[model samples]
Target chain A: MEKEICISELKRLSHLYDIEITVAKKAGRRWSYIVNAGEEKFLPSQIVDQFEGYALFVEGKDFDNEAVVNAFRKIIKKINAQKGG
Target chain B: MITESSWIKKVIKEEEYKKYMNGEKDFINDDEIMQKIEKNKNPDPSKIRNIMKKSLEIQTLSPDETASLLNVTNPLLWEEIYETAAKIKKKVYDNRVVTFAPLYCSNYCVNNCLYCGFRRDNKEEVRRRLTLEEVKRETGVLAGKIGHKRLIVVYGEHPLSDAKYIANTIQAIYSVKAKTKNGYGSIRRVNINAAPMSIEDLSMLKEIGIGTYQVFQETYHHETYKKVHPSGTLKSNYQWRLYSMHRAFEAGVDDVAIGALFGLYDWKFEVMGLLYHAIELEKRFGVGPHTVSFPRLTPAKNAPYVQKTKYKVSDENFKKLIAVIRLSIPYTGLIVTAREPARVRNEVLPMCTQTDASTRIGVGAYSLWGKEKEQKLNRQQFLIGDDRELDTVVRELSEMGYITSFCTAGYRCGRTGKNIMELLKSGKEGSFCKLNAILTFREWLDDFASEETKRAGEKIIKREMEEVKKSATRAYSPQVVEELENYYKRIKNGERDLYF
Candidate 1:
C-alpha cells in the first residue's frame, strides 16, 4: 500500500540531512522528490522500490528511523560510486 | 570630479564578496592540490593509458590522473598522448577550426600587476578606453571588412569599464551591420575577457545577452599571485577572483571561461591547477569551463618581468602541455591565441579547437589600421606573434583540409550551460555543429572570402558535404537535409547568415 507524504516532512528531512530537496510533478497529479548534494543528483522514489519498507518511510507512513537511514546510505553510496570513489 | 578612490569604492563591493565566501574560505585548496601532485609523482604507463581511455570517452579526468599525464616523459608515450589528444579534439569538436578576433576595448587598469603592460603604475603605456561609438566603428571593420563572426573583447579592470559600460559596449557591437560582397556582415557572438564582477553586476550583463564570461586566474600559485598583484589591490584578493565563476553561475550566466598565464609558474603545476579547477566546477555545479586558454608570457615595453621570467615554457614543453590539457578535459574548448608565432601555432593547431587571427591588442586598432600596423608595445597589452590577416589564415586552414567555422547557432539554439555539456559528452553536439558549420562557411565564402581563398575553400566544402551526407544522415533528417541544401545554394547566390 502507498501512503502520501506531506511536503513539510520532506523539507524537514532535507534540512536535517543538509541536502537540497525539490518536488516536481512527474506526470499528471504524480509527484517526485529530487535529492541533490552539490552536483550529485538522485531520486529517492526510484530506489525506494529496491528496499523493503523504504517506500513507506519515504511517504511518512512508517516511522522506522533505522530503515530510513539505511535507505539514504544506500543512495549516497551509489552516487559516490558513480563519482569514481 | 570623480576621484579614483571613489571609483574604486564603487567597483569592489565588500558585502557581495562576503556572501559567496565559505566563512573566510572558498574553493582552490592549494595544499590539497600540492599533496595530490606529490603523491602521484611516478605513475605507471598502464595506468596512464587507462586514464587516457577515460578521456577518449569524453569524461573529465580527475586531478590525480591529470598529474600523472603531466609527469609523462617517455618519448614514445608522449607521441601516443599527442595522437590521442588530436583524436579527442576531432571526436568532440569535429574537424572545424573556429576563429575569432581579439578586440581590446580599454587599457585603463586599476591594479599594478608586475607582468602586464596595462598595470596602473606603468607610465609608458598609453591609457585609453573606447566610447560606444568607437566600439561600433571597430566592430564595423571586424565584421564587415575582416569577416570575423566572433570576438573576445578584452578590458582592463577599472571603473570606467564597469558592468554597465560592458553591457553598453556589447550592445553597440551587436548593433553594427556592415556591407559585404554578397550580403550583410555582423558580429554574431561577443565573448568577454575582463575582471571579475559581483553577482548583481553579472546578472545585469546576463540580461543583455552576453556570450561566455571569461576571467583568467593569471596564476593559480598563491604566493606568485600575491607577488604579482600587490597587496591592498582588487586583484590581490585571490579568493574573490577564484570564486568569480561560482558567482557568475549563480547570476544566471551559462558559459564561463578559465585560464592561467604560463611562465608565471611551473607549467606542469599550472596544468594540474587548471584540471583541479575544472573538476571542482563539475563537482559543485555539474558544468566545467566552456574554454581553457594557455597564453604564454610575451614581451611588453616596460614590463620587464615578462622577458625575465625564470619559468618560461619552451616550445617543445608548450606543445606537450597543450596536448595534456586536451586529453585531460576532452569536452572543453582549448584556445591557442596569436601570442605564439605562426610556426608554433601550426605545430599545436591539431590539438586546439580555436585560435585568433588578425588580432589587434590595441584599443581602436581595427579602426586605426594603417597607423597601428607596427606592433607598438606601449599601446598594446602584449605583442602578438601572428599578425597574418584573416584571409591568409582562411587560405591556410583550407589548404590543410580543415573547415573554418563561424557558427554561433549552438548558443542561440539553447545548446548552452548544462545542455551543451551533455550534448558534447554524448558526441551529438559535433553532428549538429557540422551541419551549421557548413551553412556558415558557405555564407562566409560568399560574403567575405577573397577569390584565391574561395577557390581553395570550395574544394573543402564539397568534400565536407560528401562526408555529411555519408555519415550524418540520421542526425539531419531528409527534410532538414533538403532545407540545408537550399540554404547552401542561397548563400552562394547572395544570401547570408543562414543557419539551421
Candidate 2:
C-alpha cells in the first residue's frame, strides 16, 4: 500500500477501536508494538505494519485485549489488497 | 532543489509567515521586556515568595513575576529562590538527569554572526560538513562505544546542509545499531540545532523522526541582533528567527526548543525575553517549548565579538539565570550544556534537568576523540568546558543521587506535544521519568559502564527501586509495579531497551 494510505487506514482503525497510536521508528522486520500500555510485543512485518514508524503504541485502558491489534492488522491487509499487493 | 542565490529568498514563505505574526511584527516587544525589568526592581520578599509559589504550582509565571525574580539582589532571598527552583525541577522532572552527545555535523555557514566562529567571514576557521557515512561512523562511537541513546545533531545553515541534508543525516544516525556488550546501542532521539526553516521543510523533518527542533534566537534584542547578524544575510531577519517555533508548530512538529546565546545582551533582559518567548508559544499552541537552552557566550576562535561583548554573564549571574528560568517556566526542561566548567556545572545542575556529557562540538570529533587530548578551536564552534568521559560524569551524578537517564521512551510512547506539556505541568511525568530512568540506566550500566562507575550506578538504582516500592499504590498501578520489577530483573539478566 502507499505509505500515506496505510497510515490513514491505521488511524481509522485506531479511532474505530478508540485507541491512540504514537508513531515510532521506521518499518523493519524486527519492529515491536505495545497494546493497552502493557508489555512490548514483537511485530511480524507481514502482520503488523505502519507507514512512518513501526512501533505503534496503544495506551490507556479503553481497548479490548488483542482486538485493537487484530483490527489494525486487518486494515493493513485490506488496504494492501485494495492496492493489488 | 534550490539554487544558491535564490534559496535564501525561498526559505521564508511570506504568506504563511504572516499568519503567525502580528501584522509585520513578531511577538517579542523590546520596550515591554525592558520596562518589566525596570518596574519589577526592588521587589518585596513576600511578593517573591508568592511568585515562587505560583511556580511550585507548575504555573507559568507572568513577565512581572519573572522580572521580580530576576531583580532579586538580596543574597538571603536569592538562596530562597534557589531552593524553590530546585524544588520545582524535582517536582516536574524528578531527580533524573538526561545525558546526550552533541554531534556537530557541519561548520559551513551563510551568515556572518559576529559571535560565532562559523561565520562566513572567518577565514581561519576550518569548514567541513560530514558525509552520511561519516555521520554513521560518528554515531557508532557515540552509541556503540559510549552508550549514548540520544543525540542533539547540529548543522550549520548553508545550502549544502539544509533541511533535506538534516533529514538524511537523522536517518543515518538512527540506522546505526552498533553491537555493544549484551545488546545494541543506537540514537533513538535526534534533536536538530540548525537554522530556521519553512513549514514544508519542518514538516518533512518531523515525518523523518526528528525530535526537538531547536533554533536559538542567539540574542533577542533587535539592535544587537542586527549588529551581530550582518545585513543581506538570511539570519538578519529577526522575525523569521523569532517565529521559528511558530512555524515549527504550524508544520505539525510537536516538540520545539527555544534558547538564547546569553552574553550578547543583558542577562536579565535575555531571561525576560526567554520568558516572553515561552509565553508566546503557550498562548499560540497550548504548549510551550519542550526545552529551554541558555548557553553563555564563551570565546570562539576568530570571533573577536566574544571578548568585546560587555554583557558577559558572570558565573554568579549564570546560576541566577538558571534559577529564574526554572521558576518562570516550571514545566520546561532546562539544559545546562558542557560550556560551563565542571565546578560551575556542579553548582548549577541542582536546578537544571538535562545536560550533555563527553560532548564534542568539532565537526566529526567523536570518531577522532581518543587521538587528541585537546580540541582544535578553529574547527570547533566554541570551546567545551567539561570534557570528562561519560562514565566519569555518570559516576559523579550517581554519587550526587542522580540517575543518568538514557531513556527516549517518552518520545516513542507518544508523551510529546500537548500530551507531554499536560503531564509535566501536573507533575505526573515525574512518575514515568523515574520508572524509565531506572530501566534505561540499567541498560547503560550493563552495556558500557566502568567497574567503579557501575558500582556507584547500582547504588542509585537500588535507591530508586526502594523509592518506587515505598510510593507503591499512590503513584503507580499495581500491575505497573509488578511489571517494573519483572522488567528490572530481565534488563539485569542481559535484555535491552525495555520500558513501561
Candidate 3:
C-alpha cells in the first residue's frame, strides 16, 4: 500500500533528518519517493528503491542508526495507510 | 498589442528587482570583480593547485580562487587545469553528455540590444512568433523525427510572446505525442531561455513544470550592458536582470540557469562575472545555477557590433574560459552550445556536461527545414556554428566514449534545486547519471538512430554495461544492479521511459 504524505509533513521530516525527500512519479509497482541520506548531515544520499518496513537508508558511523530506521518505518506506515485508503 | 513602452514598463517590476538588492546595490560589484582580477594576476602554482583541489572536492571556488585560475599563463599549468576540469566533470556527472535542441519561439522584442539580430531596430529582419499549433508542429519535428527529449525554448522579449504566451507554448510543446520508430515521442522537459519574467509569471511556469528558467545577463559588465541594451528599455535595467534568479527562487522555480555573452567584455572579467553570479545564487538560495552558458559573439543580421566588438573571445581564450568555469563551479552543469563550430565543440566537449544538437534557431526553422535548404539569417537570432544532424553527433560522441543521454528523469524526479546541489557536491549524482544515460541512449538508438549510430551506440552501451557490472559492488549495490539489469532488459524488449 502507498500513502500520499502531505508536502508539509515531508518538509518537516526532511528538516528533522537534514535530508531531502523528493516526491517522484509512482514508478512501476512501487518506489514513489527518492529519499536521500548521505554521509554528512544535509547531503543528498543514495537512491532507495523500496520503502519496506524498517528499510534503513542512512549511512556512516555518526547517527543513531536504529532510531532513524524505526522513525522511517513509522513514517512509511502512515504514508502507506493514506495511499491504501 | 500593447504599445512597446508600456509593455517594457510592465515587465520590469521594481519590487522584484529591489527585493534581492542590498540597499541600492545588486550582487555584481563591478569594481570588486575587476580588482580581484587585477590582484590575482600572477597566481602561484601552489595556490592554483589548491584551488583545483577545492574544485575536485566539488566546492564552489571563491572569487579570488577563480580569478587566480583566470590568470594562469603557463601552457603546462593550463593543461593540468584542463585535465582537472575533465576529472571534476567525470566525478560529478560521469562520462555522459546530455543533449537538447533549441527551439526559438519568437523574435519580437522591446529591447534593442546591439548584439542581437532580433533587436527592435533591425527592420530588415523577419519577425515571427509560433502560435500554439505551430509550436506543436515544431515540437513534432524535434521530438518525433529528431528524437529529442528536451528543449531550450527561446523567446524574444515582447508582449506578443509574453509570460502568458510562454506558458501556452510550453503546454503546447508538452502536449505533442508524435510517432517514432519504436514508440511515441514527446519532449519530457522544456527549459525556457526567455527574458527575465515577473514572480507571478515565473510561478505560473513553475506550476506548469517548466524545466529550467534561463536568462543570460548578456554581459555582466554594467556599462557594457547598458550600452548594448540601450537606455529606456526593459533589458537595460541591469539590476532587474541580475536579480532574475533570486526572483525565480522566490517564485518557487528552483532550477535556474545563468549565463553571459563572453564577447561583450574581457574574457577574464566575464569569467569572474559568471563566478560571481554562481556565488550570489549559492549564497542567497543555498543552490547555484543548474547550468552556466558562455555563448561568445556570433554574427547577427545587420548587427555590426558582432564584428566591431573589441572584446570578442578568440577560440583559444574561449577554451580557457570554459575550463575555468568548469573548475570554478564544479557542481554546476557547464553548457557549450552549437553556436561553436564542430572543431571548437570537439575540443571543449571533454569538459562540458551538456550541449545542444540538431539545433535550428530561426523562429520556425524546424518545421521549415526541408522547405528552405539554406539558412535565412533574417529569421534567426544568430548563425549557429555547428549544424550537424543528431545522428552524426550521437555517433561521434559514442566514438569519443561518451554516451549521449536524453535523460529528463532527474528533473522529473525532483533531483533539482538544493537536492541536486547536494547530490552534485557529494558526487552521488553520477551514479544516477550513469544508469539513466544507458537507459535513454538505448531508447534513442532504437527509436530514431540510423544504422551507423545504432552500431556505435550499442558498442558504447556494451562497454558501459561491463563497467556497471565491474563496479557493481563498488559504485552500485547488488540490489540496485539487479533493478538496473531488469530495466535494461525491459527497454531492450521495447518498453520505454524507464530510469533509475
Candidate 4:
C-alpha cells in the first residue's frame, strides 16, 4: 500500500519547505530510508548531511523526551536545509 | 530521391504561416470538402478514395498543407478519416489500449537544456535522485498510487544516475508489491525513458524486463535541437536521440515509445516523420511504436526559448493532430499527458488517448496542481492543463461515450513484438478478437463506463459483429454459434459482466 507520513501536524507545518520522500523499505520496524538526502544534488553529497529514513521529523530534540507537536519545528528546519537555505 | 535541400525547409517554414497554398495539398478547396460537409450525414464512402489519396499523397506536408488539414471543419470527413484511422488502430491493437506511467527515479540532470525547468542552471530548481533504498521507498508509494499494470520508469541520466543504478531501480519497482496483487499485477511491467544510452545500458534495462524505451526527439531538426537543448550530451549528438529507439531495439528492446515534442517542430512534417518512423520500424522489426506521446509545452522556469521551439498546435488543432495519429498509426497507444487544461483534457480523453490514475492523482498530478490553495512537489517540469480528479475524468468520459479502461493487454496476451505483428498481419479474424470485444464491452459496462456509454457500446458491437461476420468468411459449428449468440443476447439483455 502507498505509505504516508504518519505525522499530520509535521506534514502541515513542514509541507512547504520539507521534501516529501518516497518512503522506501522500513528496516527494524521503523527505521526506513524515505529518500537519500544528497543523492539528488548537483554538488557533492559528503559536504552536507543527509537523512534516508522510515521516521518522520518530529518537533522535539529527543524522541524519548519531547512532545510530538514540537517535531514539526525540527522537521521544518530539516526541510529548509534540504532546500539549500 | 527525396529532396534534402535546405530550400525545402523554407517551404515548410512558409506553409506553417498558411500564406502559400499547394493546390494538391489543400483539402478545404477540394470539391469533396463541401459535399462531405453537407448538413448532418454519415460520411460518403466515395470520398474515401480522395481522402485516402490525400492522406497518402500529402504524407509529408509543407506547413500550409498541414494547417489546412488541421483546419478540416467537415464533420463527415473527420468521422471518416478517424474511422479509417481507428480501423488501422484496431488492426494492431484489437480493442486494447496499452497503459503505463513514468516512475521518476531521479530528477537530477547534468544538462542545461534551455527549455527544461529541471536544468541545473535554473537555481530555483529542486532536484532529487531516489537512492536504492529510496528508490524502493518511492516504488512502494507509487505502487499504492498505481493505476495501471505497466510501469514506465523515467529518470534523468546524470553520471551519478547511471545505467546500473537505473537497472537496479527497475528491478526494485518490479519486485515491490502494490497493495498486493501478488505478482498477478498492480504494475507487472516496466518501460524506460531517459537519456540515450549505449547498447550495454539498454541490455541491462531489458534484462530488468524494461518493455519499451522512450526517447523523445523533441525536434528532428538539428540546429534547433542544439539551440533548445543548449548544453548537454543531448545537444552534442542529435542523431543519438533520433536513433536511440533503433539502438534499443538492437539491444533486444522491441517495444519503444517514439515521439517528438509537438510544439517544437513543423507539426505536419513532424507528424508525417512520426508515421515514417513507425513505417521504418515496421519494415525493420515487424512492429511500430508500442506507444506515441504528444506532450505540448507548458510554462516552465528558465524556459524562455520555448517560442523558438515553436510549432504551436492550438487545442482544436491538437484534437485534429490526435485524430491524425489515430488515423496514422491507428493501433499504437496514443498518449496525452497532464500538460493540458481540465476542459481540453476531458474533451479529448477518448479520441486515441492513454493515461493512468496515478498520473491524474496523488503525485503525478504535480503538473496539474496549478495555483491551488496548497500543493507539494519536488518541483515540476511544467504546468498541467487537466485538473480533474480520476473519478471526475472517468465520469465525464463515460457520459461523453468512451470506454474508461484499465485493461492491460500486454500482460495477459503474448502481445509484445512479433506476436502482435502476426495477429494483425495474418488478415484473418480469430477467437482472440471475439473474446477481447466481449470482455472489453462487459468490463466497461460493469465498472469504468457510464450507463449510456455501455448501451452505446452494446449497440455498436451488435452492428460491428454483423459487419465482422461479412468481413470474416470462417464458419463455426452450431453449438459455438449458439454460445456466441447467447453471450451477445445476455449482454444486450443487461446481464452481469463476466470475464471469459
TM-score of chain A of each: 0.31, 0.39, 0.43, 0.23
Task: Flag regions of model 2 displaced more than 4 Å.
Answer: A1-56, A59-63, A66-85, B1-3, B472-474
Clashing pairs in 1: none
lDDT of 3 by residue, B323-390 (tens): 99999999999999999999999999999999988888988889975666466799898989999989
Residue-level lDDT of model 2, residues B50-104, one tens digit each, is 9999999999999999999998899999999999999999899888999998999
State the lDDT of candidate 3 residue by residue for A1-85, as single tens digits: 2323444554555566555444433322112233443233212234343355223333222444445555556667776777677
DockQ score for model 3: 0.11
Better of 2 and 4 by TM-score: 2
For residues B1-500, could you state the per-residue lDDT of candidate 4 as single tens digits? 43323322221122221222244332122233223223214434454435544444223223233334444567777666656555554443344333345566676676677777777677776777666776655565444433344566777646656788887777776676645222222445666778877676677666566656788877655556777776434434555565666677766676688887877755655565566567767766667787788877766777776756556778877777777765556456677765677677655555554664435222233333333423233365665565444444554544454444444433222234654444444422223444444544454344333455456655645554564455444343343344556665665455533222
Model 3 segments more than 4 A misplaced: A1-21, A24-85, B472-474
Evaluated on the second chain alone, the candidates' TM-scores are 0.97, 0.98, 0.98, 0.70
Residue B80 Cα positional deviation in candidate 1, in Å, after optimal superposition: 0.8
Model 3 per-residue lDDT at B397: 96
Q: Report the alpha-carbon TM-score of model 4 versus the true structure.
A: 0.62
Candidate 4 lDDT, A1-85, residue by residue in tens: 0112224543443343333222222221112222221111111011111233223322111123233324433554565466564
Q: Judge candidate 3 at residue A83 and give its lDDT.
A: 65
lDDT of 3 at B492: 85
Look at candidate 3 and give me any clashing residue pairs: A2-A83, A3-A79, A3-A83
Identify the candidate with maximal TM-score: 2
lDDT of 3 at B84: 96
